[model samples]
Target: MSNQHRMHGVFAVPTTPYNADGTQNLEQLAAGVEHALDTGIGGILCLGATGEALALSRDERESQVRAVVEAAAGRAPVVVGCMAYAPAEMSELIAEAAALGADAAMITPPFYGGLPPEAAIAALRIVMAASELPVMVYNNPHSTGTDLQPSHLVELLDTGSFWSVKETSGAATRVRELRAALGDEVEVFIGADGIALEGFSQGASGWVAASAWLLPEQCQRLWDLSRDGRWGEAIELWKGLGAALGQIEDNPAFISLIKAALSRRGAEQGPVRPPLPSVDTESVDALLSTIDGIEGRALHV
Candidate 1:
């Protein structure tokens, strides 16, 4: 309800680490979270798309949440992704996150296709009713067929139960439209990395991105530049990193690229889980070269 718990600036979605045996490497995950916090990220989001939330088991999800929360250590909010097709299951996930000391739950509408918008909205309302922590509406129609139109968001967010919305439509204009429609009724965060500058120009309050995890200082610089109204400088900064950001946005190896970049940066995020192969060395090398050209050694080629 209040803006007290709302997150601003960059919230890095750290990738989940795994041991060679495929068990969750929570210690590695916690180390990465601590590193992100040290770079001054506004918050941490566990079990996000970048984190491969759906690939993890329930127990693994709880372990990851606990690791991130402890790693953040109250320096920033820890928002857990609680995505489920059923409202009861979502509520269960939220309860687990709450018990694990998460600050909030980021939820998307049910992923099942052909579900009407009303069903999505109704499902969110039901889950929110049972959630102990505040909820952030994650509208990522690309991954989930259900799209929460601005009208639907107006209805759900107007209830004052939601803390924010992550708009990942990949269209920057949606940020402008949401701002125009909502007018500060709910904080809007840009979930796509490529359009971040455009989203900021259009009044997005923050960013929830994998790039933010891989390149925290640079991403934070972009957020700071935008926040300070230095449009010219922001444009120049974004342009400098366009190549790497483009790879982040459009590559099929979205998660893999982020992980490889993090490992290249010396954070050591291991392989992605099954069904999702790691990006080839050639792709990783090319991305690293592009990243190095940005003039920061924080990301070595």
Candidate 2:
């Protein structure tokens, strides 16, 4: 089925905030989402790698999706990360997300097996076939191991199963190649935060931005600048944001850092779930400094 909605702008991949008792903090989570919407974020994506979906229970995933969708309240589109070990598992996630009122599903090849391109394609096709909602194929090579090449994406998009792709190979050139291959047939969202400016320069239609969780207004302004062809202003804004965005994409404890930033800003984002340790004090301080420094810069656009 063709996706009727053409997603664009800053889609925030929010961290799943938890309470100290290890329960899902639905209230705090909803409040954070509400803030993102109020600050002009274009979309909400729950259960992404940034959200520690691999670490959460099925019930927790459901709760988070429900909270975010309800908090969005039709003001913006919401996409649920539905990547799983197999087609049936992914189909279950997609169904649950769709039932919870998500606008679309962001899916990837099963990460565990290191499947080759052909096998990965087959698995994704099976999952997409079972999905009731529009699917945005998520191509995160670092986390997933399987790289969805532009050619692979073209093949999949040709099937009419996917309406968009989150290209996270971390190469801005991939955006150029995908644009060259598919033209306007599908939306291409840059998934890596560090290369956002380059990706936008190369024709990425949107950004699935983790940084937006902390800096929604800044992220949205960058999107507006890029969309309006104000590269000079966008580049300058990106320069101010580069340090924070780099840390978000490059740091080993990025999720912890994100939660810490939110907590510092007075949001009730508790510690990240364990097995994922907390951000170092120094790193948190540095992130805060970078963010503070960026915030001081006037958005010259």
Candidate 3:
């Protein structure tokens, strides 16, 4: 499939595994990619937010991208999440993504301390200008503290450089606004695990989920529910799933909790690079308790 088209279904941002020395575990990364692809996910976006892209040095980011690109070996599109501060940094990161033979590159607005809407639009313009490759914008206003407004995002979409957006900030309405504005001209991905099923229901092309790293089929089932016009089923799942999915981020040790969840599902060996603490056994028990509350409650752990 051409990378130029909308990345569909449940695209997973697999966590970047680290050895004790803080170097990326390429072998494990490759394994993760293969597992995600085999589990019937759509695309693999490495070095994304959930992958702790911001924490990695540029060289480390490049290594993670390279491993994902190489591991996919053309089975599915591999997009490198180009997370950086300045446009110049984005240029280098995106250039590396493209150089590594990535199918596409993703960009998050300036993280930490936020950017004004105009500043974000301008910054993204510069970033897109630097790359010939298609771009996917990442919008997680909760973490970035800056959001891509539906209107301003329309302007950014007008640039045609951005092929999609992974909307993570619980703005499910933006998917409708985006569809109304772009009309299939661009792809809109639901980035909020809490709202992913709703996002898919409301014309969102797909989801780029951190939760999907562990629950690939579960997430995919949600997508299937939305696509199949099973609104009652989808809503029932969404209303309950949101609460549990929301937990992966709220706990003090968020990333570690994510890795632990994946580990429990047999995707073991992922250790979120410290100062992020691993999920304690108590937290694990709590997570399981929450998972049990889901409709099916058939979680692997």
Candidate 4:
């Protein structure tokens, strides 16, 4: 609302690293956070969609959140994605996030067949009741199947219970709608990486981009360019990084392809969690080619 703690800027939804046996790779995850912090972006979001948050167990998610908070060491705020089916479990994750010294939490409504607005608000309220920490309502209907719409979200903000939101609905028109309806009231963050330019242009404060794992400076450039009325430059950079976003945003499991791309860069954070599967050799090859294309453009520039 009043913008006191709006997560406004290039927030990175970094990938989670697992070992060959699918165990959590804390060391590699720490390294990823360090890279993100050094990227000079605004925040590092561990255990997010890009981090395979859903694929992680509750215990694993807590540990991952703690790992990112520790790695950051206050360089930038750590926003943990606390996702769960039940409200109690969500609250448990929120408490764990606060206990781990997380600066804020990005929470999504529970995904199921489809939830009513009442159920959605109830889930968010459960999360809000559990912690004194700021809570960001993360809406991505594509993932959740149901949502707490702008009207419902605005009402929540009016109560002073919830904090901010990361809007991943992937519609620029909705960005404009939220800003128009609650511009001076709520803290709105753009979530989708592909449509970042459009979202920011419509008045979103920042992005929790998937491409942030490799393209932090590019995201920063886009943010700065948009702020400075440099849409042309921002779009160029966004276009340049399109491949990386495609590998994740359109994929079944976002974390898998992200790690695959990182492997090409020599980070090699191992496989994605079970049910998500590792990226195939062909996908990996194409992703590397795309990265090379981006690098080639940079070189020519």
The per-prediction tally of clashing pairs is 0, 0, 0, 1
Model 4: weakest 10-residue lDDT segment is 154-163
RMSD per candidate (Å) reads: 2.3, 1.6, 3.0, 2.1
By TM-score, the best candidate is 2
> Per-residue alpha-carbon lDDT of model 2 for 49-103, expressed as tens digits?
5458889989888888988999999999999998888789899988899889999
Most accurate candidate by lDDT: 2
Tens-digit lDDT string for candidate 3 (1-301): 1355656778888887766776777888799888778878888877776557767887787777788888899888888877777889888877778888998888888878588978888988888866767888888888787888677777775565778878876754788887887667678888777777667768898888877776676677778888898888777766656676778756868667877866676666567765656778787777766776773554522
- Please list all clashing residue pairs in model 2, or write none if there are none: none
Model 4, runs deviating above 4 Å: 1-4, 49-51
Sequence-dependent TM-score of model 4: 0.92
At residue 161, give the lDDT of candidate 4.
43
- Candidate 2, residue 97: lDDT: 90
Q: Which candidate, 3 or 4, would have the higher TM-score against the true structure?
A: 4
Stretches off by above 4 angstroms in model 1 are 296-301
- With a 3 Å backbone cut-off (N, CA, C), the pairs that clash in candidate 3 are none
Q: Which ranking of candidates, highest TM-score first? A: 2, 1, 4, 3
**Which is superior by lDDT, 2 or 4?**
2
Which regions of candidate 3 deviate over 4 angstroms? Answer: 1-3, 236-243, 289-301
Q: For model 1, what is the error of residue 253's alpha carbon versus the real structure, in angstroms, after optimal superposition?
A: 1.6
Query: Candidate 4 residues 1-301, lDDT tens each?
Result: 3455666788887777778887888988888888877868888877774356777777887788888889999989888777888878777777888899998877787876478777788667766766567877888787788766677776666445466678877664888888776665566778887777888888877788778877777677778888888878777877867656776577765567777778778887887667776667787677778778877888888
